[model samples]
Structures are given as C-alpha cells and as structure tokens.
Target chain A: MADTAKIDYKNIFYPPGGILLWIIIYLELLTFGIALVFMALNARTEPEVFHESRMLLNTAYGAINTVFLLSSGWCMAQSVHFLKTENFGKSKLFLKLTLLGGILFLALKSVEYYDKVEAGLTVGYNVFFGYYWTLTLFHVIHVIVGIVILLVLGRTLSKKPETLKVEDYESGAAFWHMCDLIWLLLFPIIYLLF
Target chain B: MERTFNATWLVLIVLTIISAVFANLDFAYAALIILGLSFLKFIGVAFFFMELKRANVFWRVLLVAFVVLLLTVVWAV
Candidate 1:
C-alpha cells in the first residue's frame, strides 16, 4: 500500500520565534536558573550578610528598571501589533520607544553598579555580592544584546522597508521578552529576596 | 488591543509599586507575597505582551511550568 501519511498543519505550532530560537531561550533560561538556584542556596547559608549586602542595593532602582522593561515590552508588542496591522509608521515609532527603554534601563543600571563598586563592594566582596554582581551583570549583557537586536530590526525596517518578515520582527521581540522574564526572576532574587 | 495592552501595563506598574512598598516589611511571608506578585507580572508580560495567550498548549504550559519551577526552587531555598 502507498504511504497515506498526512501533514498535520493545524497541530503544528511554531511560536512567533522559530523553534531554534525557543531552544536557545531554554538554554539561556537554564543557565540563569542554575545561577539563581545557587544564589538562593547560598543565601540560606549567611542570611545576614546577604540581607545586609542586598540592602546596599537599591530596591527602588530595581523597581524602576522593572517598570522600564515592562513598558518597553509593551512597546515591542505594540510594534508587532502595528506591523501586523500594516501601520509601518506606527510600528517604527513604537520600536524606537522600545529601544529608548532599553537605553534608559542600561543607564540606570550602570549608576546602580557604580555606587556598589565605589562603595568597595565587588563581586568577590562576599557570596551574596558575588551572585549579585555576577547575576545582574550577566543580565545586563543580555539586555545589551537585546537592544542590539532591536537596533538591527530598526535598521532593516528603515533601510530595506517592506523586506522584513513578521517573524523577523517577532524573533527580536521574543528575545526582548526573554530579557524581561530573566529580570523578573532576578529582581526579586537579588534585590528583594535578601 | 490597545486598551487591553494599556490596562495590562497599568496593572503591571501597580504591582511593581506595591512590591516596592512592601520591600522593607518585617513579615515572615513578605518575600513569598512579593515573589507571587512578580510572577503575576511575568504572567501578564508573557501572555499579553508576548502574545502567548493564544499559543498552543505546549508553549503555554511550558512557560508557566518554568515560572512555577523557579518559584518552587526559590521557595525551597
């Protein structure tokens, strides 16, 4: 008998990002997840040191950072939404707004780190500060990457307009959202969980 | 969609503000409460902003499970 296999189109789910993108996301999350777990376990050892060091860090700044990222996330979503609706101008505008958010986040984060280093609290200062700097700096690197991705998207949209696929826009947005998710885990862990 | 996004954004901001205010509280479960709220914010971002609300079962479940795993491991520690 001939093969009667049929492709199940409706059952296939390729998230906004390509499948490989999700795999990369999973790996990134796992890397951070292990770090977070180590931090938490280590925190249980010297709660006092961790809490004291954590207090040196600014909760308000972390909150502000969260707000900025969340707002930027909203902007990215809007950019994609407008793009889907075929409103190129609005999409471009929102993408710019999203990039601005990333810029502001990096700026504020740098100031926060500056205060820490100036206070003589480097990553090796203690276990908590170690994780504090390590985890947050790693996240900072991801944010930088996320911003660069957005800029590339912006460039493509501007220079080659109409050559961009919706998936291309969403691929960048999904990665940006991954950044948001990582921070959401980190904010409470490093800044608040104490 | 605009209104939905705006309202969700407002709610997320409110949650963050609430968490910040509760930062220095001297309660035993304060951390849990704050983490819970942050998780809620994550939910909003993932579902609404990331367009995961209509995602197939696997992706949605996987994301939620990941969040839960983080919460559980953190709480355990």
Candidate 2:
C-alpha cells in the first residue's frame, strides 16, 4: 500500500522535466495579457474613432484565418499523440500537415493585408487603423514565429527520429495554440463587436 | 493510452460554426455568447487536445489562473 501511494504521488505532482515549459507558457500568457490591457485602454479613450476604423476590416478573412488556426491546432494535437507513441512516420506526417496549415494561414493573411493596402487603409490613416494594424501585425508575427518552430520541429522529427523531443513539440504546439486562441478573441472584438 | 480524436473536437467545430451564426443575429447578448463559447472552446483545446487534463494539478491551476486573469483584464478594459 505504501509503495502504491508513493507511485501515485509521483505520477500526480512530480512530472520529471515539465517545469521549464510551464514557466515559459506562463510568461507568454502574461505578455499577451499586458498587450490586451494596452489595447483595451486605447480603445476606451477613442471608442468612436476605433469603431469607425474597424469597419474597414474583412470579417470573411478573419473567419477563414480562425478556421485555419483551429485546424492547425488539431493537427498538432494529433502529432503530439503520435510522437508519444513513438510512431515517427505518423508523427512526421502530421507535423507536415500542421506546417502546411500554418503556411496557408500566412498566405491568406498576406492577401488580406494586400487588399487593405489597395483599398487605401494604411496604418497611419487613423488612430484606430494604427491599433488595428499593430495588433493584427503583431499576431501575424507570432504566426510567423509559429511556422518557423513548426518547420524546425518537422525537420527534427524527420531527420533525427531518435531524439523525438516530445516536450519541445508539445511546447511549440501550446504556443501556437495560444496564438490561435488570442486571435479567436481579437477577431470578434475587431470585426464582430462593431 | 491509444491516441484518437474525441468528441471535444466535434464540439469545437460546432461551436465555431455557432459563433459565426450568432455574430449575424440581431440579439444584444449574442456577442457575449460568442465570447463565452470561444472561451469554452479554448479550454477544451488546452485541456483535452493539449493533454493538459492529464497534467499535474499545479500546472492546471496555473493555466486556469492565467486564463482568469486574462478574463479579468478583458473585463476591466
């Protein structure tokens, strides 16, 4: 009974090496919260300006991006599972799928930005446009970071299957999911709330 | 445990569609519902698909606290 209790305790509270990943995750969330507060205060001060400027955004593009990110998250989840089971081939395949999704998201986002530029909705046009472009561009930067991480992970999984690095994969996936989740909030706030 | 996508994925997909539909409605509280559902979907992805459900309670508490803090910040804004 004592041995069983010890085993249970170990399983419950003392994961061997997940602390670093958790700390990084917390810090990322903190940074996102700070940015959200900054934007919210800016919006509150100039509600009319922000609302009028928000009208220029394309909701369809925002929705499509949301779906893309969600699907990418799904694929990453599958890859994580496959990695855990040591199925290198399946893991590599799913990671490639995830990378494809990320690429597609970026391509669509670029097209959306191009459309905005052609329509003369430049960032310096107004305070709201400034915030809108800053926030969305900041998110786009994160997506780019996520894509790079996915590419690295895919490469590692394909080349060095022995060094699976499940934690790295999981952390990268978590970060990507965070990016997606934030956009899920931002999309509605920018496009639908008006 | 054998890896297989669960009902949560289906629920997330349905909620995403519902959120889009709700956005078009004339109801005053539709936005709130959409936000609420989005929060639920986020939690589902974090806990289930990310396998955080099987993680240590400390980690779970940390995540929940961070999310609550984010929600509070949003509310304050």
Candidate 3:
C-alpha cells in the first residue's frame, strides 16, 4: 500500500482519482448545477405549479433513496479505504454492499417513475415535470454508468485483486459519490422545496 | 478514515431526516433551512466520501465555491 501521507496532495495531478477524473467531475457538477439553477428560476415564475407538482412526489421515497445512496457512498469510501490498507477481502465485501445500494436505488426510482407515469406526470406533462424528467433522467444515466463501472471494477478486484490499481478503485468511488452528490442537489429542490 | 466516513454517513442520514421533517412544516424559512442542510450534506460527501480532504487546495476551494454559488443562485430565485 502506498503511504497516503507521503503523497503530495498539493500536486495538481495527484488527487485520489487523478486529475482527469477530477476534471470530469467538475464538468459534470457544472452541467447539473446550471440545470438546477434554471429549474429554480422556472419555479420562481410559477410557484403554484412547482409547489403542486412537488406535492405529487413521494417524499418518503426520496428520503429513503437518499439514505440508500449515502449508505452506498459510505461503502464505496470504505472499500477504497480497505483497498488502501491492503485488505482485499473486506474491500470486496464493501464493493458488493455498494452495488446492492445502487441496485436498490435504481429499483426504487423505477417504481417512482412508474407511479408518475400512471398519474400522467410524464416529461411533457408540464414545465415542472419537464425539468423533473430531464434532470433526473440525466442523473439516472450517470447512475447507470456508475453501476457499470463498479461492476467492472468489482470483477477485476474479485478475480485479481493484485491487478487492480488504487487509482482505478478510487476513480470508481469518486464517480459513485458524484451520483450521491447530484442526488443531494436534486432531492431537496425537486421533492422538498417548491 | 473508517471512523470519519462512518461519522459523516451518520450525520448525512440525520440531516436527511431533519430535511424531511422540515418539509412537513409550512413556513417561509423551511425551504431555506432545507436547502442549507442539503448543501451541508453535499459538502460532507465531497470532503469525506470523495476524499477532497486529501486533495489539493484548489480542488477543495473549487468545490466550496461551487456550493456557495449554487446556493446563492437557488436562494435568489
């Protein structure tokens, strides 16, 4: 295991997942941030529509999914930590837990989507659902990609732990946490706030 | 690192619950408080789970600035 303390964190090229992933992270956050700002502005123009549309959302599901994602994020961080400490067995276990969390979130989100569709709240339903579907569907795509990345990394780690670089593991964790962070942005503005 | 991550997760869950509770209450500032808690959650995940604490200062400050700018825009709207 490399000594994390010995590494010069001040180096622009040496974040946990490397500079390239950090760049992607920044760009991704900016994209979502701009969309959210637009949504807020749109809400300001039609507060009643936004408020009533928010009422149709199930806060319990949003809150529960937040727990699921956050817990998974914790597992991902733990997996990386164990990898750093050279505990491959525990690291693999945590990776599985993280995958489970992602799966649960996707499953629950599908149910929520189904409910909305049944209630005639599709993307073109109104401006509010327009933002809802676009922002969340974009986030869902990221989560799907994140899950695929984790699956690939988990396979490599399980079959050949020695072959998995710490950088690769950390990069996967970073992407997964990006999903968590984006959801944190979306949940409050969409489900809680009008 | 384990303790820190665990503690951070606990705080995030608690904050989520608090946000949910506040969502139930109708008040002018409930939205503000909930958004504030959400931003706090964002910071916790970025710093602890994403390991920004070990990153360069530029990355850390960039994230903080992003959150502040986002919060300001959302609040202004």
Best by TM-score: 3
Tens digit of lDDT per residue, candidate 3, span B1-77? 89999899999999999999999998889988998999899999999998898888989999999988997899888
Model 2 chain A lowest lDDT segment of ten = A1-10
In the range A1-194, model 3's lDDT, one tens digit per residue, is: 33334456568678877788889998999999999999999999999999999999999999999999999999999999898888989999999999999999999999999999998999999999999999999999999999999999999888888778888788889999999999999999899998
By summed lDDT, the worst window of 10 consecutive residues in model 2 chain B runs over: B1-10
Q: In candidate 1, how many Å is residue B19 off? A: 1.1
Compare the candidates by lDDT and give the number of the best one. 3
The lowest-lDDT stretch of 10 consecutive residues in candidate 3 chain A is A1-10
Model 1: per-residue lDDT, tens digit, B6-54? 9989999999898887778998888888889988998998888877776
Report the CA-based lDDT of candidate 1 relative to the real structure: 0.85
lDDT of candidates 1 onward, in order: 0.85, 0.72, 0.92
Per-residue C-alpha lDDT of model 2 across residues A1-194, encoded as one tens digit per residue: 00111212135444322556556656766776677667667888887877677667877787787778777878888887787777878878888888888888889989999998998898898776776788789888988998888888788777776765666677788777767766766776666654
- Candidate 2 lDDT at A113 equals 91
TM-score of each: 0.94, 0.85, 0.97
- The per-residue C-alpha lDDT of model 1 at residue A142 equals 94
Q: What's the residue-level lDDT of A164 in candidate 2?
A: 51
Off by over 4 Å in 3: A1-6
